[model samples]
Target: MCGIVGLLVKEPELRESLGALVVPMLLGMSDRGPDSAGLAVFTELLENCNSTGVVPSITRKYSLYIGQHQIDWTEFTHNLQQIGNAIIKENGNHAIVVSDCEPNLLKQWIKQHYPQLHILSTGQTIDLYKDAGNPAEIIDRYQFGLLTGTHLVGHTRMATESAVTPAHAHPFTAGEDFCLVHNGALSNPYSIRRQLEPQGIQFETDNDTEAACRFLEWRMREGDDLETALQTGFEALDGFYTFLIGTKDKLALVRDAFACKPAIVAETDDYVAISSEFRSLAHLPNIKHARIYEPAPEEIHVWMV
Candidate 1:
Protein backbone atom coordinates (compact mmCIF):
# COMPACT_ATOMS: atom_id res chain seq x y z
CA MET A 1 0.00 0.00 0.00
CA CYS A 2 1.04 3.63 -0.58
CA GLY A 3 1.47 6.09 2.28
CA ILE A 4 -0.98 8.97 2.78
CA VAL A 5 -1.22 11.97 5.16
CA GLY A 6 -3.85 14.67 5.74
CA LEU A 7 -4.13 17.67 8.09
CA LEU A 8 -6.40 20.67 8.71
CA VAL A 9 -6.06 23.71 10.96
CA LYS A 10 -7.83 27.05 11.37
CA GLU A 11 -4.73 29.10 12.13
CA PRO A 12 -1.90 29.99 9.77
CA GLU A 13 0.53 28.65 12.35
CA LEU A 14 -0.84 25.25 11.45
CA ARG A 15 0.96 25.48 8.15
CA GLU A 16 4.24 24.95 9.95
CA SER A 17 2.52 22.56 12.28
CA LEU A 18 1.43 20.51 9.31
CA GLY A 19 4.84 20.53 7.70
CA ALA A 20 6.44 19.47 10.94
CA LEU A 21 3.84 16.77 11.37
CA VAL A 22 4.10 15.35 7.86
CA VAL A 23 7.82 15.48 7.08
CA PRO A 24 8.71 12.61 9.36
CA MET A 25 5.52 10.87 8.39
CA LEU A 26 6.71 10.92 4.83
CA LEU A 27 10.17 9.87 5.91
CA GLY A 28 8.89 6.97 7.99
CA MET A 29 6.72 5.66 5.19
CA SER A 30 9.45 6.22 2.65
CA ASP A 31 9.87 2.54 2.00
CA ARG A 32 6.21 2.00 1.22
CA GLY A 33 6.53 4.33 -1.73
CA PRO A 34 9.79 5.45 -3.28
CA ASP A 35 8.63 6.43 -6.74
CA SER A 36 6.80 9.74 -6.24
CA ALA A 37 5.45 12.12 -3.60
CA GLY A 38 2.85 14.91 -3.67
CA LEU A 39 0.77 17.15 -1.39
CA ALA A 40 -2.32 19.38 -1.69
CA VAL A 41 -2.92 22.35 0.63
CA PHE A 42 -6.35 23.98 0.96
CA THR A 43 -7.05 27.31 2.63
CA GLU A 44 -9.28 30.36 2.41
CA LEU A 45 -7.88 33.59 0.99
CA LEU A 46 -7.43 36.40 3.47
CA GLU A 47 -8.19 39.90 2.28
CA ASN A 48 -5.33 41.03 0.09
CA CYS A 49 -4.92 43.28 -2.94
CA ASN A 50 -3.47 41.99 -6.15
CA SER A 51 -0.98 43.77 -8.42
CA THR A 52 -3.91 44.76 -10.63
CA GLY A 53 -5.50 46.57 -7.62
CA VAL A 54 -8.44 44.19 -7.63
CA VAL A 55 -9.88 43.98 -4.14
CA PRO A 56 -11.59 40.87 -2.83
CA SER A 57 -10.15 38.98 -5.76
CA ILE A 58 -10.73 35.25 -5.83
CA THR A 59 -7.77 32.92 -6.30
CA ARG A 60 -7.64 29.22 -7.13
CA LYS A 61 -5.43 26.33 -6.07
CA TYR A 62 -5.09 23.27 -8.25
CA SER A 63 -3.48 19.80 -8.22
CA LEU A 64 -2.44 17.04 -10.62
CA TYR A 65 -5.81 15.45 -9.92
CA ILE A 66 -7.14 17.10 -13.04
CA GLY A 67 -5.67 15.61 -16.16
CA GLN A 68 -3.54 17.84 -18.32
CA HIS A 69 -5.60 19.08 -21.24
CA GLN A 70 -5.04 21.54 -24.06
CA ILE A 71 -7.37 24.51 -24.22
CA ASP A 72 -6.97 27.86 -25.97
CA TRP A 73 -6.39 30.37 -23.17
CA THR A 74 -7.49 33.26 -25.37
CA GLU A 75 -10.76 31.58 -26.30
CA PHE A 76 -11.30 30.50 -22.71
CA THR A 77 -11.02 34.13 -21.59
CA HIS A 78 -13.48 35.27 -24.25
CA ASN A 79 -15.95 32.65 -23.01
CA LEU A 80 -15.50 33.89 -19.44
CA GLN A 81 -16.55 37.36 -20.60
CA GLN A 82 -19.78 35.92 -21.93
CA ILE A 83 -20.45 34.33 -18.53
CA GLY A 84 -21.02 37.82 -17.07
CA ASN A 85 -18.89 39.43 -14.37
CA ALA A 86 -15.77 37.32 -13.72
CA ILE A 87 -12.02 37.64 -13.35
CA ILE A 88 -9.42 35.17 -14.53
CA LYS A 89 -5.87 34.65 -13.37
CA GLU A 90 -3.43 32.08 -14.70
CA ASN A 91 -0.66 30.35 -12.77
CA GLY A 92 1.83 27.58 -13.57
CA ASN A 93 -0.25 25.29 -15.78
CA HIS A 94 -3.33 26.30 -13.75
CA ALA A 95 -5.87 29.13 -13.63
CA ILE A 96 -7.36 31.24 -10.84
CA VAL A 97 -10.73 32.44 -12.12
CA VAL A 98 -13.73 33.86 -10.29
CA SER A 99 -17.28 35.01 -10.89
CA ASP A 100 -19.82 37.27 -9.17
CA CYS A 101 -21.25 34.32 -7.21
CA GLU A 102 -19.86 32.45 -4.25
CA PRO A 103 -16.89 30.22 -5.21
CA ASN A 104 -18.62 27.15 -3.85
CA LEU A 105 -21.81 27.86 -5.79
CA LEU A 106 -19.83 28.49 -8.97
CA LYS A 107 -17.90 25.26 -8.49
CA GLN A 108 -21.13 23.35 -8.03
CA TRP A 109 -22.54 24.78 -11.24
CA ILE A 110 -19.43 23.76 -13.15
CA LYS A 111 -19.55 20.23 -11.82
CA GLN A 112 -23.18 19.85 -12.78
CA HIS A 113 -22.77 21.08 -16.33
CA TYR A 114 -19.16 20.24 -17.21
CA PRO A 115 -18.55 16.97 -15.45
CA GLN A 116 -16.10 15.77 -18.09
CA LEU A 117 -13.80 18.76 -17.95
CA HIS A 118 -10.79 18.66 -15.62
CA ILE A 119 -10.93 21.91 -13.54
CA LEU A 120 -9.01 20.78 -10.45
CA SER A 121 -8.97 22.64 -7.14
CA THR A 122 -10.77 25.94 -6.46
CA GLY A 123 -11.12 28.35 -3.52
CA GLN A 124 -9.25 31.49 -2.48
CA THR A 125 -6.32 29.26 -1.49
CA ILE A 126 -5.34 25.88 -2.87
CA ASP A 127 -2.02 24.43 -4.03
CA LEU A 128 -0.95 21.04 -5.35
CA TYR A 129 2.61 19.93 -6.08
CA LYS A 130 4.01 16.58 -7.15
CA ASP A 131 7.09 15.36 -8.93
CA ALA A 132 8.63 12.18 -10.16
CA GLY A 133 10.82 10.28 -7.62
CA ASN A 134 11.04 10.21 -3.81
CA PRO A 135 9.23 12.52 -1.41
CA ALA A 136 12.38 14.27 -0.22
CA GLU A 137 13.55 14.97 -3.74
CA ILE A 138 10.16 16.26 -4.82
CA ILE A 139 9.85 18.49 -1.73
CA ASP A 140 13.33 19.86 -2.24
CA ARG A 141 12.65 20.58 -5.89
CA TYR A 142 9.36 22.35 -5.22
CA GLN A 143 10.04 24.01 -1.82
CA PHE A 144 6.77 22.43 -0.61
CA GLY A 145 6.62 24.14 2.77
CA LEU A 146 6.88 27.66 1.28
CA LEU A 147 3.31 27.20 0.07
CA THR A 148 0.79 28.05 2.80
CA GLY A 149 -2.70 26.77 3.55
CA THR A 150 -5.01 25.55 6.33
CA HIS A 151 -5.66 22.01 5.13
CA LEU A 152 -3.21 19.63 3.45
CA VAL A 153 -3.23 16.10 2.03
CA GLY A 154 -0.22 14.20 0.72
CA HIS A 155 0.80 10.84 -0.76
CA THR A 156 3.83 8.78 -1.75
CA ARG A 157 3.24 6.39 -4.60
CA MET A 158 4.74 2.91 -5.07
CA ALA A 159 3.19 2.37 -8.50
CA THR A 160 1.36 -0.84 -7.85
CA GLU A 161 -1.06 -0.72 -10.81
CA SER A 162 0.07 2.28 -12.82
CA ALA A 163 3.24 3.65 -14.38
CA VAL A 164 5.49 6.05 -12.49
CA THR A 165 5.21 9.66 -13.65
CA PRO A 166 4.46 13.12 -12.29
CA ALA A 167 1.08 13.22 -14.03
CA HIS A 168 -0.02 9.97 -12.37
CA ALA A 169 1.00 11.14 -8.92
CA HIS A 170 -1.33 11.53 -5.96
CA PRO A 171 -3.47 14.47 -4.81
CA PHE A 172 -5.51 14.49 -7.99
CA THR A 173 -7.78 17.50 -8.42
CA ALA A 174 -11.28 17.33 -9.95
CA GLY A 175 -11.92 21.04 -10.15
CA GLU A 176 -10.64 24.31 -8.69
CA ASP A 177 -11.14 23.23 -5.04
CA PHE A 178 -11.61 19.48 -4.90
CA CYS A 179 -8.74 16.99 -4.65
CA LEU A 180 -8.16 13.38 -3.62
CA VAL A 181 -5.11 11.20 -2.93
CA HIS A 182 -5.61 7.49 -2.77
CA ASN A 183 -3.58 4.56 -1.34
CA GLY A 184 -5.12 1.47 -2.80
CA ALA A 185 -6.49 -0.04 -5.97
CA LEU A 186 -9.95 0.11 -7.47
CA SER A 187 -10.48 -3.51 -8.56
CA ASN A 188 -13.06 -2.48 -11.13
CA PRO A 189 -12.00 1.03 -12.07
CA TYR A 190 -12.60 0.44 -15.76
CA SER A 191 -16.23 -0.48 -15.20
CA ILE A 192 -16.79 2.63 -13.11
CA ARG A 193 -14.96 4.71 -15.67
CA ARG A 194 -17.26 3.38 -18.33
CA GLN A 195 -20.28 4.30 -16.25
CA LEU A 196 -19.00 7.84 -15.85
CA GLU A 197 -18.01 8.30 -19.51
CA PRO A 198 -21.65 8.42 -20.55
CA GLN A 199 -22.15 11.33 -18.14
CA GLY A 200 -19.42 13.22 -20.01
CA ILE A 201 -16.70 12.53 -17.46
CA GLN A 202 -13.26 12.49 -19.09
CA PHE A 203 -9.97 10.93 -18.00
CA GLU A 204 -6.56 12.09 -19.08
CA THR A 205 -4.70 9.12 -17.63
CA ASP A 206 -5.64 5.48 -17.32
CA ASN A 207 -5.31 5.41 -13.55
CA ASP A 208 -8.36 4.49 -11.50
CA THR A 209 -7.62 7.32 -9.05
CA GLU A 210 -8.94 9.81 -11.60
CA ALA A 211 -12.09 7.76 -11.86
CA ALA A 212 -12.58 8.13 -8.11
CA CYS A 213 -12.26 11.90 -8.39
CA ARG A 214 -14.85 11.98 -11.11
CA PHE A 215 -17.06 9.74 -9.00
CA LEU A 216 -16.90 12.26 -6.18
CA GLU A 217 -17.76 15.07 -8.57
CA TRP A 218 -20.73 13.15 -9.88
CA ARG A 219 -21.97 12.37 -6.36
CA MET A 220 -21.57 15.98 -5.27
CA ARG A 221 -23.77 17.01 -8.20
CA GLU A 222 -26.36 14.45 -7.10
CA GLY A 223 -26.73 16.52 -3.90
CA ASP A 224 -24.75 14.08 -1.79
CA ASP A 225 -22.81 15.60 1.08
CA LEU A 226 -19.14 14.62 1.32
CA GLU A 227 -19.83 11.90 3.85
CA THR A 228 -22.74 10.62 1.82
CA ALA A 229 -20.70 10.68 -1.34
CA LEU A 230 -17.92 8.67 0.22
CA GLN A 231 -20.27 6.15 1.77
CA THR A 232 -22.14 5.89 -1.48
CA GLY A 233 -18.87 5.43 -3.33
CA PHE A 234 -17.92 2.52 -1.10
CA GLU A 235 -21.12 0.78 -2.10
CA ALA A 236 -21.19 1.77 -5.73
CA LEU A 237 -17.62 0.99 -6.72
CA ASP A 238 -15.80 -2.30 -6.66
CA GLY A 239 -12.43 -1.81 -5.06
CA PHE A 240 -10.11 -2.05 -2.10
CA TYR A 241 -8.83 1.43 -1.42
CA THR A 242 -8.61 4.27 1.09
CA PHE A 243 -9.01 7.89 0.05
CA LEU A 244 -7.98 11.18 1.64
CA ILE A 245 -10.07 13.92 0.08
CA GLY A 246 -9.76 17.66 0.65
CA THR A 247 -12.27 20.43 -0.06
CA LYS A 248 -12.15 24.08 0.92
CA ASP A 249 -14.29 23.43 4.03
CA LYS A 250 -13.79 19.76 4.86
CA LEU A 251 -11.31 16.87 4.87
CA ALA A 252 -12.47 13.27 4.61
CA LEU A 253 -10.91 9.77 4.78
CA VAL A 254 -12.79 6.89 3.23
CA ARG A 255 -12.21 3.13 3.23
CA ASP A 256 -13.33 0.62 0.64
CA ALA A 257 -15.85 -2.15 1.20
CA PHE A 258 -13.23 -4.68 2.31
CA ALA A 259 -10.88 -2.35 4.13
CA CYS A 260 -8.16 -4.07 2.18
CA LYS A 261 -5.96 -1.06 2.60
CA PRO A 262 -4.25 0.12 5.77
CA ALA A 263 -5.02 3.60 7.19
CA ILE A 264 -4.61 5.11 10.66
CA VAL A 265 -6.50 8.13 11.99
CA ALA A 266 -5.62 10.26 15.02
CA GLU A 267 -7.25 13.49 16.19
CA THR A 268 -6.50 16.01 18.91
CA ASP A 269 -8.34 19.05 20.17
CA ASP A 270 -6.22 21.16 17.89
CA TYR A 271 -6.03 18.99 14.76
CA VAL A 272 -6.74 15.72 12.98
CA ALA A 273 -4.25 13.38 11.29
CA ILE A 274 -4.34 10.35 9.01
CA SER A 275 -1.56 8.23 7.61
CA SER A 276 -1.03 4.89 6.00
CA GLU A 277 1.21 3.79 8.87
CA PHE A 278 1.23 4.40 12.63
CA ARG A 279 4.92 5.28 12.73
CA SER A 280 4.22 8.32 10.55
CA LEU A 281 2.49 9.90 13.55
CA ALA A 282 5.72 9.93 15.53
CA HIS A 283 6.49 13.56 14.75
CA LEU A 284 3.24 15.10 15.93
CA PRO A 285 4.01 16.90 19.24
CA ASN A 286 0.47 17.70 20.29
CA ILE A 287 -0.65 14.15 19.81
CA LYS A 288 0.12 13.09 23.36
CA HIS A 289 -2.08 10.08 22.89
CA ALA A 290 -3.74 8.73 19.77
CA ARG A 291 -6.74 6.56 19.19
CA ILE A 292 -5.55 4.46 16.30
CA TYR A 293 -8.05 2.37 14.38
CA GLU A 294 -8.54 1.04 10.87
CA PRO A 295 -11.68 2.07 9.05
CA ALA A 296 -14.29 -0.66 8.92
CA PRO A 297 -15.18 -2.28 5.63
CA GLU A 298 -17.44 0.00 3.63
CA GLU A 299 -17.11 2.62 6.37
CA ILE A 300 -16.53 6.30 5.81
CA HIS A 301 -14.61 8.49 8.28
CA VAL A 302 -15.06 12.21 7.77
CA TRP A 303 -13.74 15.20 9.70
CA MET A 304 -14.85 18.78 8.93
CA VAL A 305 -12.07 20.94 10.26
Candidate 2:
Protein backbone atom coordinates (compact mmCIF):
# COMPACT_ATOMS: atom_id res chain seq x y z
CA MET A 1 0.00 0.00 0.00
CA CYS A 2 1.00 3.63 -0.42
CA GLY A 3 -0.08 7.00 1.00
CA ILE A 4 -1.13 9.95 -1.13
CA VAL A 5 -1.97 13.57 -0.28
CA GLY A 6 -2.80 16.71 -2.29
CA LEU A 7 -3.50 20.36 -1.52
CA LEU A 8 -4.71 23.14 -3.81
CA VAL A 9 -4.37 26.66 -2.48
CA LYS A 10 -6.25 29.38 -4.26
CA GLU A 11 -4.14 32.09 -2.74
CA PRO A 12 -0.37 32.12 -3.12
CA GLU A 13 0.18 33.05 0.52
CA LEU A 14 -1.75 29.97 1.65
CA ARG A 15 1.01 27.79 0.22
CA GLU A 16 3.22 28.77 3.11
CA SER A 17 0.47 27.61 5.43
CA LEU A 18 0.23 24.20 3.76
CA GLY A 19 3.49 22.85 5.16
CA ALA A 20 2.09 22.64 8.68
CA LEU A 21 -1.01 20.99 7.25
CA VAL A 22 0.94 18.36 5.33
CA VAL A 23 3.47 17.37 8.00
CA PRO A 24 1.08 15.61 10.32
CA MET A 25 -0.90 14.08 7.52
CA LEU A 26 2.20 12.54 6.00
CA LEU A 27 3.33 11.32 9.37
CA GLY A 28 -0.03 9.72 10.00
CA MET A 29 0.47 7.72 6.86
CA SER A 30 3.94 6.41 7.66
CA ASP A 31 2.67 2.90 8.21
CA ARG A 32 1.22 2.66 4.75
CA GLY A 33 4.58 2.98 2.99
CA PRO A 34 7.93 3.38 4.69
CA ASP A 35 10.34 2.87 1.83
CA SER A 36 9.97 6.24 0.15
CA ALA A 37 8.29 9.65 0.26
CA GLY A 38 7.67 12.43 -2.25
CA LEU A 39 5.84 15.70 -2.91
CA ALA A 40 5.08 17.91 -5.95
CA VAL A 41 4.22 21.58 -5.41
CA PHE A 42 2.97 23.91 -8.17
CA THR A 43 2.69 27.70 -8.24
CA GLU A 44 2.16 30.51 -10.77
CA LEU A 45 3.56 34.04 -11.17
CA LEU A 46 3.46 37.11 -13.43
CA GLU A 47 6.67 38.80 -14.47
CA ASN A 48 6.97 42.58 -14.15
CA CYS A 49 4.93 44.23 -16.90
CA ASN A 50 6.98 46.61 -19.07
CA SER A 51 6.10 49.75 -21.02
CA THR A 52 7.69 48.63 -24.31
CA GLY A 53 4.34 47.08 -25.38
CA VAL A 54 6.48 44.01 -25.89
CA VAL A 55 5.57 40.70 -24.22
CA PRO A 56 3.97 41.23 -20.81
CA SER A 57 6.71 41.00 -18.18
CA ILE A 58 4.86 38.04 -16.66
CA THR A 59 5.03 36.14 -19.98
CA ARG A 60 8.80 36.53 -20.29
CA LYS A 61 10.15 33.87 -17.92
CA TYR A 62 8.03 30.91 -16.78
CA SER A 63 5.63 29.31 -19.24
CA LEU A 64 2.90 28.79 -16.59
CA TYR A 65 1.93 32.46 -16.97
CA ILE A 66 1.89 32.15 -20.73
CA GLY A 67 -0.10 28.96 -20.41
CA GLN A 68 -2.84 31.13 -18.92
CA HIS A 69 -2.92 32.98 -22.22
CA GLN A 70 -3.36 29.58 -23.90
CA ILE A 71 -0.55 29.99 -26.41
CA ASP A 72 0.32 26.61 -27.86
CA TRP A 73 3.96 25.92 -27.08
CA THR A 74 4.66 24.36 -30.47
CA GLU A 75 2.85 27.11 -32.36
CA PHE A 76 4.45 29.84 -30.27
CA THR A 77 7.89 28.43 -30.96
CA HIS A 78 7.17 28.40 -34.67
CA ASN A 79 6.04 32.03 -34.45
CA LEU A 80 9.09 33.00 -32.40
CA GLN A 81 11.42 31.44 -34.95
CA GLN A 82 9.87 33.52 -37.74
CA ILE A 83 10.55 36.94 -36.25
CA GLY A 84 13.49 36.77 -33.83
CA ASN A 85 15.95 34.67 -31.82
CA ALA A 86 14.22 32.17 -29.51
CA ILE A 87 15.03 28.95 -27.72
CA ILE A 88 12.52 26.50 -26.25
CA LYS A 89 12.87 23.88 -23.53
CA GLU A 90 10.19 21.39 -22.56
CA ASN A 91 9.87 18.86 -19.79
CA GLY A 92 6.83 16.65 -20.25
CA ASN A 93 3.55 18.63 -19.87
CA HIS A 94 4.85 21.08 -17.29
CA ALA A 95 7.14 23.54 -18.99
CA ILE A 96 8.03 25.52 -22.13
CA VAL A 97 10.76 28.14 -22.21
CA VAL A 98 11.21 30.83 -24.87
CA SER A 99 14.13 33.22 -24.66
CA ASP A 100 15.29 36.29 -26.64
CA CYS A 101 11.88 37.49 -27.77
CA GLU A 102 9.71 40.57 -27.31
CA PRO A 103 7.41 40.10 -24.29
CA ASN A 104 4.56 41.93 -26.04
CA LEU A 105 4.76 39.71 -29.08
CA LEU A 106 4.68 36.65 -26.88
CA LYS A 107 1.68 38.06 -25.00
CA GLN A 108 -0.13 38.80 -28.24
CA TRP A 109 0.48 35.30 -29.49
CA ILE A 110 -0.80 33.83 -26.22
CA LYS A 111 -3.87 36.08 -26.20
CA GLN A 112 -4.80 34.90 -29.65
CA HIS A 113 -4.57 31.19 -28.84
CA TYR A 114 -5.29 30.66 -25.13
CA PRO A 115 -7.36 33.31 -23.43
CA GLN A 116 -8.81 31.08 -20.70
CA LEU A 117 -5.67 29.88 -18.93
CA HIS A 118 -5.06 31.95 -15.78
CA ILE A 119 -1.82 32.97 -14.12
CA LEU A 120 -1.92 32.47 -10.31
CA SER A 121 1.71 32.63 -9.22
CA THR A 122 5.13 32.94 -10.86
CA GLY A 123 8.87 32.13 -10.86
CA GLN A 124 10.16 28.65 -10.06
CA THR A 125 6.60 27.75 -9.03
CA ILE A 126 6.47 23.98 -9.22
CA ASP A 127 8.66 21.73 -7.06
CA LEU A 128 9.13 17.92 -6.95
CA TYR A 129 11.07 16.25 -4.12
CA LYS A 130 11.41 12.55 -3.41
CA ASP A 131 13.82 10.07 -1.84
CA ALA A 132 14.09 6.51 -0.58
CA GLY A 133 13.13 6.74 3.10
CA ASN A 134 10.35 7.28 5.65
CA PRO A 135 8.22 10.43 5.60
CA ALA A 136 9.83 12.07 8.62
CA GLU A 137 13.32 11.47 7.41
CA ILE A 138 12.55 12.68 3.92
CA ILE A 139 10.70 15.78 5.12
CA ASP A 140 13.44 16.72 7.56
CA ARG A 141 16.15 16.27 4.99
CA TYR A 142 14.26 18.14 2.33
CA GLN A 143 12.90 20.87 4.64
CA PHE A 144 9.56 20.30 3.01
CA GLY A 145 7.85 23.02 5.02
CA LEU A 146 9.90 25.76 3.46
CA LEU A 147 8.41 25.02 0.07
CA THR A 148 5.57 27.44 -0.62
CA GLY A 149 3.31 27.10 -3.63
CA THR A 150 -0.33 27.21 -4.72
CA HIS A 151 -0.77 23.43 -4.67
CA LEU A 152 0.98 20.17 -3.82
CA VAL A 153 0.64 16.37 -4.02
CA GLY A 154 2.64 14.01 -1.82
CA HIS A 155 3.27 10.24 -1.52
CA THR A 156 4.90 7.60 0.66
CA ARG A 157 5.77 4.22 -0.82
CA MET A 158 6.36 0.72 0.48
CA ALA A 159 7.63 -1.44 -2.33
CA THR A 160 5.99 -4.81 -2.56
CA GLU A 161 6.97 -6.15 -5.99
CA SER A 162 9.49 -3.54 -7.10
CA ALA A 163 13.04 -3.16 -5.82
CA VAL A 164 13.67 -0.70 -2.99
CA THR A 165 15.57 2.17 -4.63
CA PRO A 166 15.28 5.85 -5.41
CA ALA A 167 14.53 5.07 -9.04
CA HIS A 168 11.34 3.30 -7.95
CA ALA A 169 10.26 5.92 -5.47
CA HIS A 170 6.78 7.41 -5.46
CA PRO A 171 6.06 10.57 -7.42
CA PHE A 172 7.89 8.83 -10.25
CA THR A 173 8.89 11.64 -12.57
CA ALA A 174 9.02 11.80 -16.36
CA GLY A 175 11.18 14.72 -17.42
CA GLU A 176 10.72 17.68 -15.03
CA ASP A 177 7.01 18.28 -15.52
CA PHE A 178 4.99 15.20 -14.61
CA CYS A 179 5.16 12.78 -11.71
CA LEU A 180 2.89 10.09 -10.24
CA VAL A 181 2.63 7.82 -7.22
CA HIS A 182 0.38 4.79 -7.03
CA ASN A 183 -1.11 2.10 -4.80
CA GLY A 184 -1.97 -1.38 -6.12
CA ALA A 185 -0.95 -3.25 -9.30
CA LEU A 186 -1.46 -3.20 -13.02
CA SER A 187 -2.56 -6.63 -14.23
CA ASN A 188 -1.06 -6.30 -17.72
CA PRO A 189 2.06 -4.23 -17.24
CA TYR A 190 4.29 -6.60 -19.15
CA SER A 191 2.13 -6.41 -22.24
CA ILE A 192 2.09 -2.63 -21.99
CA ARG A 193 5.85 -2.56 -21.39
CA ARG A 194 6.50 -4.70 -24.45
CA GLN A 195 4.43 -2.36 -26.58
CA LEU A 196 6.14 0.78 -25.24
CA GLU A 197 9.75 -0.47 -25.42
CA PRO A 198 9.96 -0.43 -29.20
CA GLN A 199 8.57 3.09 -29.36
CA GLY A 200 11.64 4.54 -27.58
CA ILE A 201 9.97 4.72 -24.17
CA GLN A 202 12.66 3.69 -21.71
CA PHE A 203 12.05 1.85 -18.43
CA GLU A 204 14.51 2.62 -15.67
CA THR A 205 12.68 0.45 -13.14
CA ASP A 206 10.20 -2.42 -13.35
CA ASN A 207 7.46 -0.83 -11.27
CA ASP A 208 4.02 -0.70 -12.84
CA THR A 209 3.69 2.97 -11.83
CA GLU A 210 6.42 3.77 -14.35
CA ALA A 211 4.48 1.81 -16.94
CA ALA A 212 1.43 3.94 -16.18
CA CYS A 213 3.47 7.07 -16.81
CA ARG A 214 4.60 5.77 -20.17
CA PHE A 215 1.02 4.86 -21.00
CA LEU A 216 -0.10 8.40 -20.25
CA GLU A 217 2.74 9.84 -22.33
CA TRP A 218 1.76 7.63 -25.25
CA ARG A 219 -1.86 8.75 -25.07
CA MET A 220 -0.75 12.39 -24.92
CA ARG A 221 1.25 11.84 -28.09
CA GLU A 222 -1.89 10.41 -29.69
CA GLY A 223 -3.66 13.74 -29.11
CA ASP A 224 -5.50 13.10 -25.87
CA ASP A 225 -5.89 15.67 -23.13
CA LEU A 226 -4.68 14.58 -19.70
CA GLU A 227 -8.14 13.71 -18.39
CA THR A 228 -9.16 11.98 -21.61
CA ALA A 229 -5.98 9.94 -21.69
CA LEU A 230 -6.51 8.84 -18.09
CA GLN A 231 -10.16 8.05 -18.72
CA THR A 232 -9.16 5.97 -21.70
CA GLY A 233 -6.63 4.20 -19.52
CA PHE A 234 -9.51 2.93 -17.41
CA GLU A 235 -10.85 1.14 -20.47
CA ALA A 236 -7.63 0.05 -22.22
CA LEU A 237 -5.67 -0.96 -19.14
CA ASP A 238 -6.49 -3.73 -16.72
CA GLY A 239 -5.46 -3.19 -13.13
CA PHE A 240 -6.11 -2.44 -9.48
CA TYR A 241 -4.89 1.06 -8.68
CA THR A 242 -5.38 4.45 -7.01
CA PHE A 243 -3.12 7.01 -8.60
CA LEU A 244 -2.05 10.49 -7.47
CA ILE A 245 -0.64 12.20 -10.53
CA GLY A 246 0.90 15.67 -10.68
CA THR A 247 1.75 17.91 -13.59
CA LYS A 248 2.73 21.56 -13.84
CA ASP A 249 -0.91 22.61 -14.07
CA LYS A 250 -3.03 19.95 -12.39
CA LEU A 251 -3.39 17.11 -9.90
CA ALA A 252 -5.26 13.95 -10.87
CA LEU A 253 -6.59 11.24 -8.54
CA VAL A 254 -7.91 8.04 -10.00
CA ARG A 255 -9.12 4.66 -8.83
CA ASP A 256 -9.61 1.38 -10.64
CA ALA A 257 -12.96 -0.29 -11.25
CA PHE A 258 -12.85 -2.33 -8.08
CA ALA A 259 -11.72 0.52 -5.86
CA CYS A 260 -9.50 -2.06 -4.14
CA LYS A 261 -7.40 0.63 -2.48
CA PRO A 262 -8.24 3.58 -0.23
CA ALA A 263 -8.15 7.37 -0.75
CA ILE A 264 -9.74 10.41 0.90
CA VAL A 265 -10.33 13.90 -0.47
CA ALA A 266 -11.33 17.13 1.30
CA GLU A 267 -11.97 20.60 -0.03
CA THR A 268 -12.37 24.04 1.59
CA ASP A 269 -12.86 27.56 0.36
CA ASP A 270 -9.14 28.21 0.54
CA TYR A 271 -7.79 24.81 -0.44
CA VAL A 272 -8.53 21.26 -1.53
CA ALA A 273 -6.69 18.35 0.10
CA ILE A 274 -6.65 14.60 -0.57
CA SER A 275 -4.92 11.65 1.02
CA SER A 276 -5.06 7.90 1.52
CA GLU A 277 -6.11 8.34 5.13
CA PHE A 278 -8.23 10.82 7.05
CA ARG A 279 -5.55 11.83 9.48
CA SER A 280 -3.62 13.67 6.81
CA LEU A 281 -5.93 16.64 7.02
CA ALA A 282 -6.51 16.58 10.75
CA HIS A 283 -4.21 19.48 11.36
CA LEU A 284 -5.20 21.93 8.66
CA PRO A 285 -5.76 25.36 10.22
CA ASN A 286 -8.72 26.31 8.06
CA ILE A 287 -10.51 22.98 8.26
CA LYS A 288 -13.21 23.78 10.79
CA HIS A 289 -15.61 21.26 9.31
CA ALA A 290 -14.04 18.85 6.83
CA ARG A 291 -15.92 16.52 4.56
CA ILE A 292 -14.16 13.41 3.34
CA TYR A 293 -15.13 11.46 0.24
CA GLU A 294 -13.82 8.53 -1.75
CA PRO A 295 -13.48 8.36 -5.51
CA ALA A 296 -16.08 6.15 -7.15
CA PRO A 297 -14.89 2.92 -8.67
CA GLU A 298 -13.22 3.68 -12.00
CA GLU A 299 -13.53 7.39 -11.25
CA ILE A 300 -10.98 10.12 -11.90
CA HIS A 301 -10.80 13.39 -9.93
CA VAL A 302 -8.65 16.16 -11.32
CA TRP A 303 -7.84 19.45 -9.53
CA MET A 304 -6.33 22.45 -11.29
CA VAL A 305 -5.36 25.98 -10.21
Candidate that would win on lDDT: 1
Model 1 regions more than 4 Å off: 10-12, 46-59, 62-120
For residues 1-305, what per-residue lDDT tens digits would candidate 2 score against the true structure?
88888877766678777766677777888789888887766646523333454654334343432221334656766766654444444432234354444655654555575555322112234455566777798888666676666677788888877887655777665533566778888888888899889988877679888888778868877789889989988986788888887777788889888889888888777778888877777787667675668888877788887
In model 2, what lDDT does residue 113 have?
A: 54
Least well predicted 10-residue stretch by lDDT in candidate 1? 58-67
Shift in Å, residue 223, candidate 1: 1.5
Writing each residue's lDDT as its tens digit, candidate 1 over 1-305 gives: 68888877644567655665667777777688889888887655633323445544443332322235554545644554444345455433344455544556555655664454444455555666665687887666556555556778989988888888777888787754688988888877898899988988778688889889888878997798888888778777777788889887788888876677888877766677888887888677666675567767666677775
The per-residue C-alpha lDDT of model 1 at residue 298 equals: 67
lDDT of 1 at 234: 73
Scored by CA lDDT, what does every candidate get? Answer: 0.70, 0.69
